[model samples]
Target: MSKPTALIKFKAKLSRPATPKGAAWTFLVLPAVASAKLPTRSMVTVEGSFAGQPFQATLEPDGQGSHWLKIDNVLREAAGVAAGDSVALEIAPVEKEPEPKVPADLRKALASNADAKATWADITPVARRDWIHWITSGKKAETRGKRIAAACDKLACGKRNACCFDRSGMYSKGSMGAPEAAE
Candidate 1:
């Protein structure tokens, strides 16, 4: 994929989470100046180049009004960079929204309910993203299962969006923030 003309550009050192909560992933927190240039202080999709490798991702809010990018193992390998490496980045919000992959649990729930499945198929990709985000945002397995059930019930009732979900996590009780860096 071609890299978009960068609206924001900076160099940041990647870090790993101190706790087990997000240890599987590496993260880079955008500088305050760089993060401020993005469209919103919320989760937003952007197509960017990390260490010269092209990638598209949804940046998560850091709860400090800045956003942080999660660098998966694949990207890290491809980019030839790892935690503690300061790599160059260039990013811009995607003009066209990308569809989020449906989790297996949610997919199974929707498949079993004809009404929900039909509604899911009819909703726009953006709406589908909201539902998926709402479901996946749960911190526990039980919470996720409950969300899947709730999602199906709401979809069956023709709800087009995950009502009142705080995509930004700024106001929600479960405020999504960047994980603390490992010492």
Candidate 2:
């Protein structure tokens, strides 16, 4: 029997910028900036079949284009090649768009947080989940907040993920079982 080695590159896309449902058509035509240097990375769309399952690993450039993409968790899991299996790779560059920026106010609060850990304990489970999703999305903790002041402000202002969250110390959906929900 011959040992298998070398997965293949499949469908690859330089993750286009995040777009609202309405602006999608316009975004399709945005010009690409050559300096993004998307080609220098060694891994593009790694095409191959893994564990009888066909899959493609994608290389998405981080927002700050100073290096290769963040960890390609999809490929790592797709291709069972691990431990001693030697592997080969191929790569290419495409004009990719940056993901749309999250709303400034929500981004600011999430970015400027300072009480993440302790804040969760006091909030409801739903609120806790919101905080978790907000914090975990980032790749680095240094880029996260340690306090909830910023989140609280957004909540006070009724922002969503990219907007302000409604605070009032009351769950807007009445999930917290406030007087409003009982009536």
Candidate 3:
């Protein structure tokens, strides 16, 4: 679908993640009301402006039913924004979903299984993204490995989606959301 003619606009202060202790990510949590206007609670791509600097990004769920926008170094520098600075944003969902890059491990697994690889190729980009997200969302190495194995098994069985996977992070007690503000 075409992006709405009018973009959804809001203002928020930048913040950092609480874990990792010294993470450099800068992100903003969208107001729940604004987030409700999006197509889905799961990850969604949008073209927008950050502090008036144009950008495009895939927004991630905040685990509390909202969304967070991450500002990469390039966008951060271009927007001239820093943590604690309130910035204006205007975004609209993109018409087409972008393909997610497959992780190396998942790539290797898919390569080894022809049936899984065929199903992976047959699925939609959004479905593939969901599979990738479900696999990568695992915080522990063992968890990720299990997810890759499960994904391959499901794909080999001709599963088109990550069944029962909670892409929004709302139903799952997982790491999702903007990083806590650093003191």
- lDDT by residue (2-120, candidate 1, tens digit) is 55545788999899888786576799999999988887887788987999999999898877788888889999989998889999998889987788899998998998999999999
lDDT of 2 at 113: 51
Q: Model 1: clashing residue pairs?
A: none
Candidate number with greatest TM-score: 3
Candidate 3 structure quality by residue, lDDT tens digits, 1-183: 554646889998888766668777777899987899898998999998899998889999988988998788788888888888999999999878888999999999999999999999999888999999989878899999999999999999999999888888888876566566676
Instruction: Indicate the residue-level lDDT of 118 in model 1.
Output: 97
Residues 1-183 of candidate 2: C-alpha lDDT, one tens digit per residue? 534323223322222223332221110110124213233321233333433445433342222322222223355345544322333333333223223334444455644554533343344543544443454444565544532455555544544332333322132342111111110
List runs of model 2 lying over 4 Å from the truth. 1-73, 100-105, 108-183
Q: What are the runs in model 3 whose C-alpha is more than 4 Å off?
A: 1-5
- Model 2 quality (TM-score): 0.24
Per-structure clash totals for the candidates: 0, 31, 1
Q: Positional deviation of 169 in candidate 3, in angstroms?
A: 1.5
Model 3: colliding residue pairs: 17-179
Give lDDT: candidate 3, residue 168. Answer: 88
Model 1: residue 52 alpha-carbon error in angstroms:
1.5
Give the Cα lDDT of each candidate.
0.87, 0.34, 0.88
